[model samples]
Target: MKRLSVEICVCTKCVMNGAMDIIEAVEGLKKLKTQLRLNSQVDIVTRSFCSGADVCPLVCVNGERMEHSNSETVMAKIISLTSKDVK
Candidate 1:
């Protein structure tokens, strides 16, 4: 399996939109790492502002954007992005 790296952009606007939870959602991806037995590294950054501020709480898995409003969707996106067979 290819090593996975995840990047999350959390802006102030996103914070107002509940970006903290989104951050947690990305952290949650760690569970999948252990379960999938895949060597993966996830990095989540909370920036004051992102160019995608309009899409605050934006999640990018290996440079792909995953849009959503909740943790479940975030997790699903992460899984799809990192999974060897999915992307």
Candidate 2:
């Protein structure tokens, strides 16, 4: 199973832009994926700050950075990345 690495910025700028909510969403997605028996694991990490303060919330998935991240968009990116591994 491939492990998906996720990073969420928790800087003041990020939280002010709803980064906390994104964390919750990612947790929810992790639980849902586990319940569904998906063959991959989501490993989420929190960051104190990133260079994307201007963009506020920044998310990184599989080493790729996403600017102006949001729950829906981040979730979609994860879904797309995981589904690509399905037979």
Q: lDDT of each prediction vs. the true structure? A: 0.63, 0.86
What is the lDDT for 27 in model 1? Answer: 72
Candidate 1's residue-wise lDDT over 1-87, tens digit each?
A: 455555556666667776788777677667667685545566665555357546766666666765545576777765765675543
Q: Cα RMSDs of all predictions? A: 3.1, 1.7
lDDT of 2 by residue, 1-87 (tens): 799999999998899999999999989998888554556789999987587457769999998988899999999888888878875
**Candidate 1: where are CA atoms >4 Å away?**
1-3, 85-87
Clashes of 2: 0
Worst window of 10 by summed lDDT in candidate 2: 31-40
**TM-scores, all models, native as reference:** 0.65, 0.88
- Where model 2 places Cα greater than 4 Å from the true spot, the runs are 34-37
Question: What lDDT is reached at residue 25 by model 2?
Answer: 93
